[model samples]
Target chain A: MPIDIDISHVARLARLALDDDQLELYRRQLGVILEHAARVQALDTEGVEPTGHPLGFTNAFRDDEVRPSLDREVVLAEAPEERDGYFVVPPALEGP
Target chain B: MSLADLTITEAARGLRERRFSSRELVDAVLERAAQTEAELHAYLTLDHEGARRAADQADEELASGTDRGPLHGIPIALKDNLCTSGVETTCASQILAGYHPPYDATAVRRLREAGAVPVGKTNLDEFAMGSSTENSAYGPTRNPWDPDRVPGGSSGGSAAAVAAGSALGALGSDTGGSIRQPASLCGLVGVKPTYGLVSRYGLVAFASSLDQIGPLARTVEDAIAILEAIAGHDPADATSWAGEVPDFRAELGRGVEGLRIGTVTELSGDGYEPAVSEAVASMVAELEARGARVEEVSLPTFDVALSAYYLIAPAEASANLARFDGVRYGLRVPGATTEEMMARTRAEGFGPEVIRRILLGTYALSAGYYDAFYGQAHRVRTLIARDFARAYERVDVLVSPTSPTVAFPIGERTEDPLAMYLSDICTIPSNLAGHPAISIPIGLDDAGLPIGFQVMAPALAEPLLFRVAAEVERIAGFDARPTGVAP
Candidate 1:
């Protein structure tokens, strides 16, 4: 069965704006890939634990020591838009 | 022979013996790069001045008897995805066109500390998402073997650079065969170390769990040297292994006598090209003749590795790539609102394959589909890892053809994403299991393109990989270079 995915809605969630062509193209392409991916569902994985990483280790803590960070000006210089020592961005809310 | 064509081992020996200066080596490599670059499109950024300055410094240090080990003065290429501080480190995506990272990736820093000359940043699939370098927003890198064929990517540019004698060696990240597949296709030795063996601190994340940085070089010894220099724990990357990394170069010459080698049943047989199958058989025969016991081991879960990889890697990528919003570094398309600006910037900046993966990833992790897709895929990952655990119980290492076919002509699979993904079938399982695997060029196929033979070992068993790969390298004697490229 083909997956019924709302491409536009998913794109919105992904913070991507898909044009009409991209939406149609991706819908078809993703359908084929997902169809192949459905093969994973054929196996009985009941009670089998999931693996998030290859080596199952966690919490690699470092000493609580302050290290030098990237220069603020150097970082902001690469930003697409920047103000005085801050990244400039469009407003979060729509204008009244 | 030209200094550009020397392997890392040969180059290091020459440097030590005073046969050639680092300046001479860097110059020859840059000149050769100038010769073949237009035809191959291997390097996205060639740091000629930086390379010369580094080489001169290495010479000066060596003159003062302040050596920094084997890589000192060796010209090495880096995949564009590995961030180089103060350099334009584009992952071949338009979004990062003007982005200059403030910090070096841990692996690159390690290489630099060892006095390795940075030749340039090689291209890759944008965000390291595609099988072929064709997914690169800049353009596809051609195979040095045949200009019409692909160099097998997302590490295509790195592979091409090494194969064309533009760089002695290179660093490439393998998410799902990005390093090994291209290495196989380009006829070089490529390694994807155990997941956490090398730090991922500077690498642009594709799938954090699967991404690993390793070497692409002309010889197994060279690959081992590069791996040794870069492998070890880094506090910046919490996922980095904190265990002692064995001296792989010291163990490389141990030979494969009496080593248990298993030929994975699922990765071979009917589906592969006859030449590729013959290469695998030849590898088995050679190893068996050398007293290595070979057997066909069944890893049934390997059958679903591709399916599981497609879902799981994309799911992880979706979350990891969320950092590319327009507010920070890279391209920003203006919009009336912040959300619209991010959306527009992404739509305009990322290439088709990157966009496709992000979309696929988003859908898989979406509310209603998470359990069926992303969650199920993780369980499948567990199955693959369990399969490897069982197989490794019986064999010291596993062997298979790195890819099903030699480098195919460019544009052949660009339109078919499934066909492109299928090329990674043999190499994906190892990535899923987070094991160390290396691809050694056994010989050239009938078409004269190089054929890669893969050897996989359990996690952190890079020493074993080097040992077996060294034996294979010795046995195969694969010395053929690209046709038109004269040393």
Candidate 2:
């Protein structure tokens, strides 16, 4: 099976910025990989259920209780951009 | 024997008998690590001062007659993907270049509780994505047997460190044969326990459903000792198993007599190197000679397992790696808007392979193609697991060559992603089925590189995997050591 996926569109969804060269390279490589993976589509999986988890585990619940978390200072220290006691980020929207 | 050459089991015994102190052992390993650093490039961070302090404390406790079991005072290496408190944990990617984890992974915490001292964090592929460690931003870890060849990755650094005697044993994660393949190429015993057997609390996620933490050691017994120290329930990880952890060491001496071993007809075939196939065949003959029944079995879906893995793993990876945005932790590139900042940060931080996987995964799980790609792959995964279940009814364990060939040249498979993916064909099925598997060195190939024999058993049957692996170790008697290493 031949695939003609939009490389730029996929990168947009993935939030990765790819230049023209990388987009071309990925387009070709993903084509080959998807072609190989297309082998599974030929099998008749009519009644077979999808295995999202191998161990068949379902939603795991625990006692509803608050627990001690990582120290605020330690957790915030790893942030790339931090303000006083909070993570700093770029504006959610550009100024009009 | 020199302290560097001692296995974890032997080192523990020697420490208890007063033949050597933990400080002496750690110093010996650190000295060897320094000697090999220029050539092997196996470590990302060497915690020399911390290791020495831990060793001094261990010696004090031992001198006071407080023994802390088998792993006490043993020095080991961790694959950089496992979090270490206040220590730099880069998954060999520039994306996480300066990130220092504030807490230890549950597995690392368990090792510390067992009184094991971590000497360093080893290298791996960027985000544990590639087959060869060449994808590492720091540099590739060269194979100890031949420096020109790849050590097999993304757990390459841990395997190379163990083979070179830089550390007594090490921890590595197997998403899709990362641990087993490197162990095969570098001449060591690598075990991937049943899914959920070991907690994934702090293992930097690669593929949540398929990823598992296991040990790589110079001997099966050492691997068993390391696995015992790390396996059990953890409320920190919801998927962690709640079953009782067994004493794997006690099952080591159980012979293979009357055990039914199945050889996968699909895996033992033409594409493999003659050395790899021959080694596996010879191991099978040895098992049969020891009164185990050997039979040929076929899992027709075997070939598709790799294809399904490529789809499923990458899809999950796309979701797991979403946390690496510029805001929370890791590298950040400034931009005018938040969206632009995220895109620039990811583009600059991630390597090409990681980007490629994210692209592929994103495409697979995207709106229009979800059912045709990710959904089909999940169904294929189900078929593959059922095939294993069907085959296990007639056989107690399944055997195969751990890898198709020995270590290839460093840059050989980097160009073609599919070719590198094929290197893991033999080991991927067990991961997909969520069973326990092990790779033990069978013998060296014609070029003097090692070939590995893989033994796989049912889920949570790690004791059986260890028992069979020990028998293979005895029969093969693989004692060859790499050249140009310290004694």
Candidate 3:
């Protein structure tokens, strides 16, 4: 089956910026991968439960207790932009 | 033997006996790493001074009669994906180029507690995605057996370091076949422990459910020692198994007597290189001679494992890797808007292969297509696990060639992602089933390159897996070393 990939839409969701040429490249490559993956759909999976975790464990919980945390200075040291003990990011809202 | 040549077991013994100090061992390993760095490209950052300091501390502790266990003072390498506090932990991606984790990965922390000196961080395929190390941002690690050929990856550097004697052993994470395939090509032993047997707390997330940290070593015992040290419950990771970590060393010498070893008929037939098939067959015959009941078992869904893995791994990777968006840590490409900054940072920071996978993953999990792709793959995973469950009813463990073909030339499959994905065909089933699997050097191929034979057992059955692996290792008796490497 030929796969019609909305490369731009998918890249946007993935937080990736692909130029036109690169989008064209991925359009072909991802099509091949998806075409191959499409074979799994042919197998009758009716009543077969999907396994999200191989070991079948669910809802692992621990005690709600305090523990040592990374030092604020050390954690903040890795940030590209930091001010007043907080990470600085691009504006959350555009200028009015 | 030279200090660099000592296996973890030998080095530990030497240190205990005071025959050689940890400093001598670390210096010799550093020297070997420096000499081979240009040709092998095995290490991204060698912790020369740090390793020296740790070695001195270990020596002082030993002198002061505070002996840590088997790994004390033994030099080993960590795959760059595992977090190392105060040290750079790049996943071979420019996005994480200078990111220093605030804390060591639980596995690395355990190794430190055991007194294993961190010699360096080894190279890998970016984000541990590709089969060959060609995807590494630093550069591909060359196969030590043949410098021109590729070292099967994404744990290529870890395998190469152990094979080249640069480190006594090294840890590598296997999402699909990263650890086993590379160890096979490099002629060393590699283990992908039962998923969750070792904590994934600080392993940079890549397909979290499937990714597992394990060891590559010059000998089965050495690998077991590393595994024992690293395995067990860690409250830090929710999925970490809260179970007993068995004495892997004690289980080693238990011969595979009366063991029902199954050979996957599908994996052994045509499509495999003759040398790989022959090596695996010879090992099976040897096991039979040693009283193992060898039988041929079939997993009809085996052929679709690679397809399922490509879908499932990428689907999870898409979600897991969404954390690298420029704000908190890693590379930041400033922009007018947060979305633009994320896009630009990701585009510039990640390599082509990584971007390709992200695109594939994003599309797989997108609306209107999720059921057809990701959901279907998960159903296939259930079928594959059912196949293993059925097969294990009659067989104690299963065997196959670790990789379908031996190491190819460095750039042979770089252009074709599907071709690159095929390299893990034989090793993916275990990861999907969350089983423990091991790869041991079976023998050499026609070109004198090493071939790996894989043995896989059910989850939490590493003792059985190691027992069978030890038998294969003994029968194969592969003692050949990579040429031009003095050990």
Candidate 4:
């Protein structure tokens, strides 16, 4: 694991704001984690096919069924912020 | 009645004997849940009125001798992911914050039919993504033993509720150790049913191929009892197995005397804290003393399986989560255009961790990187499976530390996602190999956190898994985690 990191790049990607203390903290922690990951990279996976899932079964599906459904009013009742029989959302776009 | 100490089995027995009614048990559990929720943050929603209504019906059914099964009149909680109709199934992410499944998950439906009352939906890491429950969009599910620490996740809430005696038994799903890790941290018996032993019809997908639903209880018998109630083929689920379900409880203590228990050299090594290692070591010794052969086996691929799991799980998650684009059933943000609505809905709905994994997964599965990452991961996965197959040929069951160490403080590994993911090192291989595993409390650490010893076996070897696990727990006795609060 490299000691150096492109903190600015990661911040840009994650939309995070990091100060010196935070950067140092993440750097130390991420380094150890990466070091551990580097050890895993050393294994002989030469002939081993990387497993996609523990259960080798693929293309699992549920039968199409019209089962008993939840009451709309009852389910809508648990919403923390609901109005007009629907979930209200905060603004997605900022006003100019 | 004291609510915190009642096991579901005891409550059910009493309910049947006419000593008490299910409504009374429901009230007691609700009272305990109220007591714990404020401090523990273990529950996201508590439907006390709903539970009472169901329990009332259960009482009426028992009075008429229409007893459902072992789970009749029992109160159990669901990890947030298992969708229950008329109940919120958030998976601890804002993206699905107000989401209610249109119908019950197959497992949820089965439990309800078995007369198990749905107590409440518990907390979890967002989308079952983190090892600790801290990543939950709402809040961390605190450890029942030490309020300052975490109940290992992503079923941490279910584990904590059982640990705190809020419910008798609960359902938790394991994908890369979600159930066992939390169960170990909270000191309970947690089982991961073989891949197809239980249907995954309504579990909100994390990694579809590896996900499984199982029982989390305070006792092996209780777990087996619950498994018996729920384990069966579901025509609804294509992956559901057609094999006849075994009577797990009847097989318990059926003589592990000659069971070929295999101890993985990779897990039982210096990497473990001396105390954690000692506890599992003692368990292996006890197995031998019980007339079992504990042989050392190799899972050389376990070293790199975590990396493969990380890649595969996230890659699958990115695809699985694409459904939540705000149009279908979840909270959607209206926009001037379709693409903006999709983008803004995801941006607003998904918590940080969910987005992080989506991005990581998308990157890994991106065209240029598919062969180098996801494809390679699949091949490596097959090799790990082969390793287990060969080892199982020589041994009946495999054992290891459920976790590398005991529960850490709540915020210990939160800042670094990679570090937290590595904590699944012992659990990922089983998921990779598609095997059945159980995490049973075996010992305690210096801080009094509980240690878990995991017993795993080849596919459909749950009966053998239980035989070995129950014996280990029977021998080790309970290594109590400090419950600073009284029920």
Interface root-mean-square deviation, candidate 2: 0.8
DockQ of predictions, in order shown = 0.89, 0.87, 0.87, 0.22
Model with the higher DockQ, candidate 2 or 4:
2
TM-score of each: 0.99, 0.99, 0.98, 0.88
lDDT of 2 by residue, B1-487 (tens): 5699898988999999999999999999998898898899999999999999999999999999888888899999999999999889999998899889999999999999999999999999998887779999998999989999999998999999999989999999999999999999999999999999999999999999999999999899889889989999999999999878776866778889999999999897777999999889988998999999999999999989998999999999999999888998899999888888999999999998999899889999999999998999999999999999999999999999999999999899999999999999999998898889999999998899999999999998888888899999999888888873444
Which has the greatest DockQ? 1
For every candidate, give the share of true A-B contacts it also has: 0.93, 0.85, 0.88, 0.29
Model 4, C-alpha of B75: deviation from truth (Å): 0.7
Candidate 4 C-alpha lDDT tens digits along B1-487: 4744666667767877788888888788888887878888878888787888899999889999797987888889888998888787888887787776768899999999899998999999988988889988898989888899889999999999888877888999998999999999888999998888898999888988889999899888889888987899997778788768766755676767888888888776656778888888888888898899888999887777887787788778888988777655676666665556666677677776676666556655765667666777777788788889889899988888899888889899887787688678898888877788999998777787899889898888787788877788789778364464455
Cα lDDT of model 1 by residue, B1-487, tens digit: 6788889999999999999999999999999999998888999999988999999999999999998998999999999999999889989999999788999999999999999999999989888887779998888899999999999989999999999999999999999999999999999999999989999999999999899999999999899889889999998999999989877866767778889999988997776999999988987998999899999999999989999999989989999989998888999999988999999999999988889999999999999999998899999999989999999899999999999999998999989999999999999998999999999999987889999999999988888888999999999999989983443
Residue B177 error, candidate 1, Å: 0.7
Reference-based lDDT, residue B323, model 2 = 88
- As for TM-score, the candidate ahead, 3 or 4, is 3
Q: What number of clashing residue pairs does each candidate have, in the order they appear?
A: 1, 0, 0, 13
Clashing pairs in 1: B105-B202
Runs in model 3 deviating more than 4 A are: B484-487
> Quality of candidate 1's docking, in CAPRI categories?
high
TM-score for chain A in each prediction: 0.92, 0.93, 0.94, 0.62
Least well predicted 10-residue stretch by lDDT in candidate 3 chain A: A52-61
